[model samples]
Target: MRAFACPHCSSLVHFENSVCLNCGSEISYSRPDRAFVLTSTGRQCANLERAGCNWLVTGDGELCDCCALTRTRPADDDADGLAAFALTEAAKRRLLFQIDDLDLPLAGRREDPVGGLAFDLLSSAHEQVVTGHESGIVTLDLAEGDAGHREQMRVQLAEPYRTLLGHLRHETGHWYWEVLVDRAARNEGFRALFGDERASYADAVERHYSSEPPAGWADAYVSAYATMHPWEDWAETFAHYLHVRDTSQTASAFGISVHGPALESEPEESEKDFDALIETWLPLTAALNAVNRSMGLDDLYPFVLAPAVLDKLRFVHDLVVARPAYVPAG
Candidate 1:
């Protein structure tokens, strides 16, 4: 996440900041200008107070661009669900910010109902809410917003890491799979790297839980979960790629320098080249894990990226950089 400054007082602010601590001026993020602006300059999102949104909007309905992506949200009367909704929306706003920063294509369902993106932020307290992506919509189980519940599921599923942001990133990956690969006419290229996505998805899910990932799976896959199926592999890899990109940018923005051996190139140079970025990322993550260990916390990044995983990451990198050229078919 990039750092922002309060336009009022020139005090350094953050992406999530809504008010200038130094000047006491209300601020909102203007996505179009990619800068902080006073709400007086433009209307704040309708969900600003309800969902804690700090985005500015300009006449495309009351909701800002990010808030507009939400198709289903907890009702006003559902107190617990609404609380969860706030947390999930915050994570999603961060995800969309990263996606926008990366120059990925982002079209709302209204823009192209057939293949455009939308979100259903639902609570699972009363019913089982499966989190996944389908037909351009990402369904999120808002109950995951509870840290205790999220950690419990992480342990139960034997996942090394899990978070609302990670969930949003992974599901959004499926949306991109359509926009950048399938709809963009790059299926052949995708199949070459990730395997045949046409394989039976239901059967793959059944087999994944019934059997252990093959030995030496880490050498090729970023996570054990990636071994489930080609589509999952792509999403997992995509999420991992987002993890690297966003963390690296935040570190750089905050001047959190790592004594990583691969810091020779400028950040822009790394942005243009996959191997170049990894060169910095690998050592940076090592340094991060070292700090975490010193503080007695789990490693910040618990997974390793082998050569095969690097190949998949490079594919995602290329796709993201070229996203402007892809247009969803109506």
Candidate 2:
């Protein structure tokens, strides 16, 4: 979520910008370069016609890296569904951008058919769709894109926070569990912090919905939903890490510091340092919540991070940073 500037005019631009307003230069995201570049080659993603994807084609005039990860999308004839799909794709692009920034490995079905990253952006209009991750495929219910429908579900489910971006971040956590955590060496440390994931997932879910979290859940878990299972606790905490990292980066990019100059210092690279992340995150969120209250809006960050939760977040941070950059075998 760092600020992007147009290469041609040096004007501030957005990640989703197609045409630079200042210089009128056409823009496209280059996967290899990981930045918005001037498209002198006139190459656009194959999905531009149907999905409004603005990323540059990587090769052979086909789908871009982000779009290629999508195994299925809503129907073209379904206008509402198509609109929702666009929003979902935008959020997914943001997610992928951060993933790339962290230099995490991304394997598609083509690379590993058995277990690799993929997406299923399904519309729930025709049928009920459960949003979850299985293997490496993440399914999202498109109806969540609609503001009204999203709010309705948020209230019904009694969730303090929910959004398209949050869903992508959360589900991708599950995908990473398979890629990064489901192993003998990693599982030992993971269990010590997040509890043994071997516990029956089905039973956990049943118990969670049938009742409520045990007393003082907030002191132990980030959210009530996190208490459902160890896997869920990991995903929820992982999503919060992304949330904190990205938002803190945005704040740094904009020269935002909460305290006065006497206390103000250079922004820390939150992606690399957990202490710096908490240092910047807590103050920023508090100020942000106050600003939202001034405008009669809810708190931007509704959850609190206890000492125990901070330990879990640190675990996620360490695991992510410790992993070597993903390089495909030749």
Candidate 3:
């Protein structure tokens, strides 16, 4: 995500900041302008009238430009005051910035008929809220914000990587594929590689849950669950694309030097080539890990860049840049 500053105080700001630490200015992300702006609306979000959140937004809501989605308020008595709500909003805006910056296609939630994307920052597993929901609306357990809770979930899932940002990226990938790729032209190729997506989804899920991920899974998939179904394959690849782009951007922005022949070529900033991207990414990741080691920190990027994974990444890039026809949902 691009760096943001408090419009009023000009101090570096976080997406979730309600009051500016430097100047005490209120911050709001405009859903229209796709920008963070100073808000005079006190400390509450304008949408609080409709939804329970009192966090600030840059201007009048014509629709949150960030996600192009809306929420009806949470309960007023929700503890953590507005801080929790603000944190959720900030994270969402950061994710939306990546979405917009990438020009990723969007599909809205099934329950909320709004044309824009949706979000569900659920209170927790113990809250009155139900445990699960579907469609374009992502239901994140608020406990996910806690480091210990997230790590526990990560371990339980046996995932190599997990983070709030990663979850947002992965879930959004599913939504994008639902609209952008699940159409016409691209069916044949996608089917050939990922298997026929026309199969019964419930059956596929049941089968996958029962069966082990394909042997040498990383040779063909980014994550093991991606092997569960074609839809998952697509989502994992999409999330990885975001992962590659955003991390590289961050590296470049920080003026970190990336050496080696792989880093020699510049990736097309407008429309990226996946091949060139990986070439740069591999070297850059090595550099990043080296730096992390210097600081006695864990590897910043923990996964290996296998050729099979690269192929999947290419499929993702092809879909995004080619705007290939979408296949029907399996």
Q: Could you list the CA RMSD of all candidates, in the order they appear?
A: 1.8, 2.8, 4.8
Q: For model 2, how does the per-residue alpha-carbon lDDT over 1-330 read when each residue is reduced to its tens digit?
A: 777878788898888888898989988888787777887755888777677787998867388888889999987799998899989998988999889877767888888777778999999898889999998889999999999999998998889998999999999999787666773258988888899999999999999999968899999899989999999999999999999878877777778887622112233343467776787688888999999999999999998999999999998888778765443322
Query: What's model 2's TM-score?
Result: 0.94
Which order, best to worst by TM-score? 1, 2, 3
Query: By the lDDT metric, which is better: model 1 or model 3?
Result: 1
Candidate 2: worst-modelled 10 consecutive residues by lDDT = 260-269
lDDT of 3 by residue, 1-330 (tens): 556678787888765565678988767655455556766633345444433332444335444444235343246676552344455555666677776566655544432364335767666544764322255566666666667877898898778787767777777776776566554456777777778877788888898878777788877887887888788888778888888877776655456546632321133443366666676678888978888999999888877767767876787777667644333243
Where is the poorest 10-residue window by lDDT in model 1? 260-269
TM-score of each: 0.96, 0.94, 0.77
Give one digit per residue, the lDDT tens place, for model 1 in 203-222.
Answer: 99999999989899999899
> Relative to the unseen true structure, what is the C-alpha lDDT of residue 225 in candidate 2, on a scale of 0 to 100?
91
- lDDT of every model, 2 decimals: 0.87, 0.84, 0.64
- Candidate closest to the true structure, highest lDDT: 1
* Comparing 1 and 3 on TM-score, the stronger one: 1
Q: Could you tell which candidate, 1 or 2, scores higher by TM-score? A: 1
Q: Which candidate is the best by TM-score?
A: 1
